[model samples]
Target: MSVVNPGDTVPSAKVVVSDHVSFEQFVVSRSRALLRTAYLLTQDRHLAEDLVQTSLAKWWAARRRVTGDPEPYVRRIMVNEFASGWRRRWRGERPTAEPPDTHGPAIEPHTDLWAALANLPRRQRAVIVLRFFDDLTEADTAKTLGVSVGTVKSQTARALATLRIDPLLKAD
Candidate 1:
Protein backbone atom coordinates (compact mmCIF):
# COMPACT_ATOMS: atom_id res chain seq x y z
CA MET A 1 0.00 0.00 0.00
CA SER A 2 3.04 2.29 0.35
CA VAL A 3 5.73 3.19 -2.16
CA VAL A 4 9.22 2.07 -1.24
CA ASN A 5 11.95 4.73 -1.08
CA PRO A 6 15.11 4.45 -3.10
CA GLY A 7 17.99 2.68 -1.25
CA ASP A 8 15.71 1.69 1.57
CA THR A 9 16.33 -1.71 3.07
CA VAL A 10 13.00 -3.20 3.81
CA PRO A 11 12.22 -6.69 5.00
CA SER A 12 13.59 -9.22 2.60
CA ALA A 13 10.83 -10.79 0.59
CA LYS A 14 10.56 -14.44 -0.44
CA VAL A 15 13.80 -15.31 -2.14
CA VAL A 16 11.96 -15.31 -5.44
CA VAL A 17 10.50 -11.79 -5.11
CA SER A 18 12.80 -9.73 -2.96
CA ASP A 19 13.30 -6.05 -3.81
CA HIS A 20 11.64 -6.24 -7.22
CA VAL A 21 10.38 -2.67 -7.44
CA SER A 22 13.37 -1.25 -5.70
CA PHE A 23 15.77 -2.98 -8.01
CA GLU A 24 13.90 -1.79 -11.09
CA GLN A 25 13.78 1.67 -9.63
CA PHE A 26 17.47 1.60 -8.98
CA VAL A 27 18.20 0.54 -12.54
CA VAL A 28 15.95 3.19 -13.97
CA SER A 29 17.61 5.82 -11.84
CA ARG A 30 21.19 4.88 -12.58
CA SER A 31 21.45 2.72 -15.69
CA ARG A 32 22.19 5.58 -18.11
CA ALA A 33 24.88 7.00 -15.86
CA LEU A 34 26.42 3.58 -15.52
CA LEU A 35 26.34 3.10 -19.27
CA ARG A 36 28.31 6.33 -19.69
CA THR A 37 31.05 4.93 -17.48
CA ALA A 38 31.05 1.74 -19.53
CA TYR A 39 31.21 3.73 -22.76
CA LEU A 40 34.19 5.70 -21.54
CA LEU A 41 35.99 2.52 -20.61
CA THR A 42 35.17 0.53 -23.76
CA GLN A 43 34.97 3.38 -26.34
CA ASP A 44 32.42 1.38 -28.29
CA ARG A 45 28.81 2.30 -27.79
CA HIS A 46 27.48 -1.16 -28.53
CA LEU A 47 30.06 -2.80 -26.34
CA ALA A 48 29.32 -0.26 -23.63
CA GLU A 49 25.65 -1.15 -23.68
CA ASP A 50 26.55 -4.81 -23.52
CA LEU A 51 28.92 -4.15 -20.64
CA VAL A 52 26.29 -2.23 -18.67
CA GLN A 53 23.56 -4.77 -19.36
CA THR A 54 25.87 -7.66 -18.65
CA SER A 55 26.99 -6.06 -15.41
CA LEU A 56 23.38 -5.51 -14.38
CA ALA A 57 22.44 -9.06 -15.31
CA LYS A 58 25.23 -10.49 -13.21
CA TRP A 59 24.22 -8.26 -10.34
CA TRP A 60 20.58 -9.24 -10.62
CA ALA A 61 21.50 -12.89 -10.72
CA ALA A 62 23.62 -12.60 -7.62
CA ARG A 63 21.39 -10.11 -5.81
CA ARG A 64 21.06 -12.26 -2.73
CA ARG A 65 24.71 -12.78 -1.98
CA VAL A 66 25.47 -9.10 -2.42
CA THR A 67 26.05 -7.62 1.03
CA GLY A 68 27.42 -4.16 0.31
CA ASP A 69 26.76 -1.77 -2.57
CA PRO A 70 25.73 -3.46 -5.80
CA GLU A 71 27.09 -0.61 -7.92
CA PRO A 72 30.71 -1.50 -7.26
CA TYR A 73 30.14 -5.14 -8.10
CA VAL A 74 28.58 -4.26 -11.44
CA ARG A 75 31.33 -1.72 -12.12
CA ARG A 76 34.01 -4.30 -11.41
CA ILE A 77 32.35 -6.76 -13.75
CA MET A 78 32.21 -4.16 -16.50
CA VAL A 79 35.82 -3.20 -15.89
CA ASN A 80 36.86 -6.83 -15.91
CA GLU A 81 34.97 -7.40 -19.13
CA PHE A 82 36.69 -4.41 -20.70
CA ALA A 83 40.02 -5.64 -19.34
CA SER A 84 39.28 -9.11 -20.71
CA GLY A 85 38.68 -7.63 -24.12
CA TRP A 86 41.94 -5.73 -23.85
CA ARG A 87 43.72 -8.91 -22.80
CA ARG A 88 42.22 -10.74 -25.75
CA ARG A 89 43.49 -8.08 -28.11
CA TRP A 90 46.89 -8.28 -26.50
CA ARG A 91 46.87 -12.02 -27.12
CA GLY A 92 46.17 -11.36 -30.82
CA GLU A 93 42.71 -12.94 -30.88
CA ARG A 94 40.60 -10.20 -32.37
CA PRO A 95 36.90 -10.07 -31.69
CA THR A 96 34.69 -10.24 -34.72
CA ALA A 97 34.37 -6.74 -36.09
CA GLU A 98 30.89 -5.39 -36.59
CA PRO A 99 30.45 -3.32 -39.69
CA PRO A 100 29.60 0.30 -38.77
CA ASP A 101 26.20 -0.07 -40.42
CA THR A 102 25.11 -2.78 -38.00
CA HIS A 103 25.00 -0.35 -35.11
CA GLY A 104 21.56 1.33 -35.09
CA PRO A 105 22.37 4.91 -34.23
CA ALA A 106 25.13 7.42 -33.51
CA ILE A 107 24.84 8.42 -29.89
CA GLU A 108 28.13 9.97 -28.81
CA PRO A 109 29.87 13.14 -29.88
CA HIS A 110 33.17 12.72 -31.67
CA THR A 111 36.03 14.76 -30.27
CA ASP A 112 39.65 15.66 -30.96
CA LEU A 113 40.57 13.91 -27.75
CA TRP A 114 38.97 10.79 -29.08
CA ALA A 115 41.40 10.77 -31.97
CA ALA A 116 44.43 11.36 -29.77
CA LEU A 117 43.17 8.86 -27.24
CA ALA A 118 42.78 6.18 -29.89
CA ASN A 119 46.47 6.58 -30.58
CA LEU A 120 47.48 5.66 -27.04
CA PRO A 121 48.91 2.25 -26.20
CA ARG A 122 46.29 0.04 -24.57
CA ARG A 123 47.70 0.10 -21.05
CA GLN A 124 47.96 3.86 -21.05
CA ARG A 125 44.44 4.29 -22.39
CA ALA A 126 43.15 2.05 -19.64
CA VAL A 127 45.08 3.91 -17.00
CA ILE A 128 43.62 7.19 -18.17
CA VAL A 129 40.10 5.89 -18.30
CA LEU A 130 40.18 4.16 -14.93
CA ARG A 131 42.01 6.92 -13.14
CA PHE A 132 40.45 10.05 -14.58
CA PHE A 133 37.13 9.08 -16.07
CA ASP A 134 36.17 6.70 -13.30
CA ASP A 135 37.56 9.01 -10.58
CA LEU A 136 39.08 5.97 -8.97
CA THR A 137 41.85 6.25 -6.45
CA GLU A 138 45.32 5.27 -7.66
CA ALA A 139 45.15 2.15 -5.51
CA ASP A 140 41.77 1.27 -6.91
CA THR A 141 42.94 1.99 -10.44
CA ALA A 142 45.92 -0.30 -9.91
CA LYS A 143 43.62 -3.01 -8.61
CA THR A 144 41.17 -2.61 -11.48
CA LEU A 145 44.04 -2.62 -13.97
CA GLY A 146 45.68 -5.63 -12.35
CA VAL A 147 49.00 -3.82 -12.15
CA SER A 148 51.22 -2.41 -9.46
CA VAL A 149 50.40 1.06 -8.16
CA GLY A 150 53.73 2.27 -9.46
CA THR A 151 52.80 0.95 -12.88
CA VAL A 152 49.50 2.81 -12.72
CA LYS A 153 51.34 5.96 -11.73
CA SER A 154 53.82 5.73 -14.56
CA GLN A 155 51.23 4.76 -17.13
CA THR A 156 49.07 7.68 -16.14
CA ALA A 157 52.01 10.01 -16.42
CA ARG A 158 52.92 8.81 -19.87
CA ALA A 159 49.35 8.82 -20.97
CA LEU A 160 48.97 12.40 -19.78
CA ALA A 161 52.16 13.37 -21.54
CA THR A 162 50.96 11.87 -24.79
CA LEU A 163 47.70 13.73 -24.52
CA ARG A 164 49.46 16.94 -23.59
CA ILE A 165 51.87 16.81 -26.49
CA ASP A 166 48.98 16.35 -28.89
CA PRO A 167 47.59 19.84 -29.32
CA LEU A 168 44.31 18.48 -30.64
CA LEU A 169 43.46 17.01 -27.26
CA LYS A 170 41.47 18.89 -24.63
CA ALA A 171 40.64 18.22 -21.02
CA ASP A 172 37.29 16.66 -20.29
Candidate 2:
Protein backbone atom coordinates (compact mmCIF):
# COMPACT_ATOMS: atom_id res chain seq x y z
CA MET A 1 0.00 0.00 0.00
CA SER A 2 2.43 2.57 -1.22
CA VAL A 3 1.41 6.05 -2.34
CA VAL A 4 4.29 6.23 -4.79
CA ASN A 5 3.70 5.75 -8.48
CA PRO A 6 6.09 3.76 -10.61
CA GLY A 7 7.34 6.85 -12.40
CA ASP A 8 6.96 9.28 -9.48
CA THR A 9 9.98 11.09 -8.10
CA VAL A 10 8.42 11.69 -4.71
CA PRO A 11 8.36 8.69 -2.36
CA SER A 12 7.03 8.16 1.19
CA ALA A 13 4.48 10.95 0.83
CA LYS A 14 2.13 9.38 3.34
CA VAL A 15 4.84 8.94 5.92
CA VAL A 16 5.83 12.56 5.48
CA VAL A 17 2.26 13.71 5.98
CA SER A 18 1.86 11.60 9.13
CA ASP A 19 5.05 12.93 10.59
CA HIS A 20 3.95 16.44 9.81
CA VAL A 21 0.70 15.82 11.68
CA SER A 22 2.55 14.78 14.81
CA PHE A 23 4.76 17.84 14.66
CA GLU A 24 1.74 20.08 14.12
CA GLN A 25 0.05 18.60 17.18
CA PHE A 26 3.11 19.18 19.25
CA VAL A 27 3.32 22.80 18.15
CA VAL A 28 -0.36 23.42 18.79
CA SER A 29 -0.03 22.14 22.34
CA ARG A 30 3.24 23.80 23.27
CA SER A 31 3.62 26.97 21.21
CA ARG A 32 2.33 29.32 23.93
CA ALA A 33 4.73 27.93 26.48
CA LEU A 34 7.57 28.26 23.98
CA LEU A 35 6.54 31.78 23.12
CA ARG A 36 6.51 32.78 26.77
CA THR A 37 9.98 31.40 27.29
CA ALA A 38 11.21 33.19 24.20
CA TYR A 39 9.69 36.45 25.42
CA LEU A 40 11.55 36.05 28.67
CA LEU A 41 14.77 35.44 26.80
CA THR A 42 14.34 38.27 24.30
CA GLN A 43 12.17 40.74 26.25
CA ASP A 44 10.61 41.86 22.99
CA ARG A 45 7.44 40.49 21.47
CA HIS A 46 8.53 40.55 17.82
CA LEU A 47 11.88 38.92 18.55
CA ALA A 48 10.21 36.32 20.70
CA GLU A 49 7.76 35.51 17.91
CA ASP A 50 10.57 35.18 15.39
CA LEU A 51 12.64 33.07 17.78
CA VAL A 52 9.78 30.63 18.31
CA GLN A 53 9.13 30.43 14.58
CA THR A 54 12.77 29.69 13.79
CA SER A 55 13.08 27.15 16.58
CA LEU A 56 9.98 25.31 15.34
CA ALA A 57 11.34 25.21 11.82
CA LYS A 58 14.62 23.76 13.04
CA TRP A 59 12.79 21.26 15.22
CA TRP A 60 10.57 20.16 12.34
CA ALA A 61 13.57 19.55 10.15
CA ALA A 62 15.19 17.41 12.86
CA ARG A 63 11.99 15.84 14.13
CA ARG A 64 13.10 12.37 13.18
CA ARG A 65 15.94 12.43 15.68
CA VAL A 66 13.86 13.80 18.55
CA THR A 67 12.66 11.07 20.93
CA GLY A 68 10.11 11.47 23.72
CA ASP A 69 9.27 15.06 24.82
CA PRO A 70 10.32 17.72 22.34
CA GLU A 71 9.94 20.61 24.78
CA PRO A 72 13.45 20.39 26.19
CA TYR A 73 15.02 19.97 22.77
CA VAL A 74 13.10 22.90 21.32
CA ARG A 75 14.00 25.01 24.34
CA ARG A 76 17.67 24.23 23.86
CA ILE A 77 17.40 25.33 20.23
CA MET A 78 15.69 28.58 21.24
CA VAL A 79 18.33 29.39 23.84
CA ASN A 80 21.19 28.61 21.48
CA GLU A 81 19.69 30.62 18.64
CA PHE A 82 19.06 33.61 20.93
CA ALA A 83 22.59 33.42 22.27
CA SER A 84 23.98 33.24 18.76
CA GLY A 85 21.94 36.25 17.73
CA TRP A 86 23.07 38.06 20.85
CA ARG A 87 26.69 37.44 20.00
CA ARG A 88 26.27 38.66 16.44
CA ARG A 89 24.50 41.77 17.63
CA TRP A 90 27.09 42.34 20.28
CA ARG A 91 29.82 42.37 17.68
CA GLY A 92 27.95 44.69 15.36
CA GLU A 93 26.80 47.08 18.06
CA ARG A 94 28.28 50.58 17.87
CA PRO A 95 28.02 52.55 21.05
CA THR A 96 26.64 56.05 20.66
CA ALA A 97 26.27 58.86 23.19
CA GLU A 98 22.53 58.52 22.72
CA PRO A 99 20.58 55.36 21.96
CA PRO A 100 19.09 54.92 18.53
CA ASP A 101 15.44 55.81 18.02
CA THR A 102 14.66 53.08 15.52
CA HIS A 103 11.87 51.76 17.75
CA GLY A 104 11.25 55.03 19.56
CA PRO A 105 10.57 54.85 23.26
CA ALA A 106 9.97 51.39 24.64
CA ILE A 107 6.76 50.87 26.55
CA GLU A 108 8.19 49.60 29.79
CA PRO A 109 6.34 46.98 31.76
CA HIS A 110 4.33 48.23 34.74
CA THR A 111 6.48 46.41 37.28
CA ASP A 112 10.17 46.98 37.95
CA LEU A 113 10.88 43.27 37.70
CA TRP A 114 11.16 43.33 33.90
CA ALA A 115 13.54 46.29 34.07
CA ALA A 116 15.68 44.44 36.58
CA LEU A 117 15.67 41.34 34.41
CA ALA A 118 16.89 43.44 31.48
CA ASN A 119 19.87 44.63 33.53
CA LEU A 120 21.37 41.14 33.87
CA PRO A 121 23.84 39.79 31.33
CA ARG A 122 22.52 37.50 28.63
CA ARG A 123 23.63 34.22 30.24
CA GLN A 124 22.34 35.24 33.65
CA ARG A 125 19.05 36.31 32.11
CA ALA A 126 18.83 32.96 30.36
CA VAL A 127 19.48 31.07 33.56
CA ILE A 128 16.86 33.03 35.48
CA VAL A 129 14.30 32.68 32.70
CA LEU A 130 14.83 28.94 32.44
CA ARG A 131 14.96 28.27 36.17
CA PHE A 132 12.24 30.61 37.47
CA PHE A 133 10.11 31.69 34.54
CA ASP A 134 10.04 28.33 32.78
CA ASP A 135 10.12 26.41 36.07
CA LEU A 136 12.88 24.08 34.89
CA THR A 137 15.18 22.57 37.48
CA GLU A 138 18.73 23.90 37.80
CA ALA A 139 20.06 20.72 36.14
CA ASP A 140 17.63 21.15 33.27
CA THR A 141 18.57 24.83 32.89
CA ALA A 142 22.23 23.84 32.76
CA LYS A 143 21.47 21.23 30.12
CA THR A 144 19.54 23.77 28.07
CA LEU A 145 22.39 26.25 28.26
CA GLY A 146 25.12 23.55 27.83
CA VAL A 147 26.60 24.49 31.20
CA SER A 148 26.98 22.68 34.50
CA VAL A 149 24.37 22.72 37.29
CA GLY A 150 26.76 24.70 39.49
CA THR A 151 26.99 27.37 36.84
CA VAL A 152 23.22 27.56 36.68
CA LYS A 153 23.12 27.83 40.49
CA SER A 154 25.65 30.64 40.52
CA GLN A 155 24.03 32.56 37.67
CA THR A 156 20.63 32.24 39.27
CA ALA A 157 22.09 33.47 42.52
CA ARG A 158 23.73 36.45 40.88
CA ALA A 159 20.61 37.40 38.96
CA LEU A 160 18.52 37.17 42.11
CA ALA A 161 21.01 39.25 44.00
CA THR A 162 20.97 41.95 41.35
CA LEU A 163 17.21 42.03 41.31
CA ARG A 164 17.11 42.22 45.09
CA ILE A 165 19.25 45.33 45.17
CA ASP A 166 17.11 47.28 42.71
CA PRO A 167 15.84 50.52 44.25
CA LEU A 168 12.48 50.32 42.47
CA LEU A 169 11.80 46.87 43.93
CA LYS A 170 12.81 47.83 47.45
CA ALA A 171 10.03 47.56 50.05
CA ASP A 172 8.04 50.75 50.34
Among the numbered candidates, top TM-score falls to 2
TM-scores, all models, native as reference:
0.65, 0.74
Clashes of each: 0, 0
- Candidate 1 segments exceeding 4 Å error: 1-21, 86-110, 167-172
Please, what are the lDDT tens digits per residue for candidate 1 over residues 1-172? 2634334577764333154436766677888878888777667887677678777777788878876566776777667666566435545876565212222233333565666676676567767887888789999988776788999899999988988776554333
Candidate 1 collision pairs: none
List model 2 lDDT by residue over 75-160, tens digit each.
89999787655524645864342121222234444446776677677788888888888889988888898989999889889889
Candidate achieving the largest lDDT: 2
What TM-score number comes out for model 2?
A: 0.74
